[model samples]
Target: MKINVEVDCTPEEARRAVGLPDLTPLHDKYVSMMMETMQGGVPPEMLETMMRSWAPMGEAGMAMWRKLFEGGAKS
Candidate 1:
């Protein structure tokens, strides 16, 4: 037997239901960094390429990535 699952709610409600906290500040920071890196604004294609390139890496790389993600690497 199979049952249907329905989801009806606003984006905020859906995020809350999944225990996902609102990440407006994080998103804003990401955008600001991307803009700074791009200098004259970043294109969607370049953003996709950046994401794809960084998506596949080991734990060490991920830690480095997170360090950069959280704003620059610690000395």
Candidate 2:
């Protein structure tokens, strides 16, 4: 025997049902900051430095990124 259940609700409702934190505000802030940076309020080198610092696993993060792209290129 098999049982199936269907849920019909908005994404917010689904998130709430799963007990996930609502990150809409944080996402909006991140998008706003990215737009500001892209509009020349921040220099390219400064953005690169910031991204490198935010990367996981410290310096190895860059190596991992390179490998990821390299694998994509081969396919």
Candidate 3:
């Protein structure tokens, strides 16, 4: 059996249909803050911390992957 469905709608419309909360304002604020940080003096450690917080696996997962890759490379 073969079936196809096509959805043609703007992102906002799709989001609304899906009952997702509108995060446009939050996203815009985050982007604006990033821009300001890049233009101003954002410390490297602060940026690193922020990036780590956003990572789903965080430092432990990244460390495991790094070790696996290094072991494979040595083999």
C-alpha lDDT of candidate 1 relative to the true structure: 0.72
Candidate 3: global Cα-lDDT? 0.76
Using lDDT, give the best candidate's number: 2
* Per-residue lDDT of model 2, residues 1-75, tens digit only: 999999899999999999999999999999788666656556656756876877798779867755764584487
Give the RMSD in angstroms, all C-alphas superposed, for model 3. 8.3
Q: 34-56, model 3: which lDDT tens digit per residue?
A: 77776687676776676666657
Q: In candidate 1, what are the lDDT values of residues 1-75, reduced to their tens digit?
A: 999999789999989999999998999999888768766655657755676577676666656655664473243
Model 2 stretches with alpha carbons more than 4 Å out = 1-10, 57-75
- Which 10 successive residues of model 2 have the least lDDT summed? 64-73
List ranges where model 3 is wrong by over 4 Å: 59-75
After superposing candidate 1 on the true structure, give the runs of residues whose Cα lies further than 4 Å from its correct spot.
Answer: 40-53, 57-75
In candidate 2, which residue pairs get closer than 3 Å at backbone N, Cα or C atoms, i.e. clash? none
lDDT at position 4, candidate 2: 100
Which 10-residue window in model 3 sums to the lowest lDDT?
64-73
Indicate the residue-level lDDT of 61 in model 3.
60
TM-score of each: 0.47, 0.56, 0.61
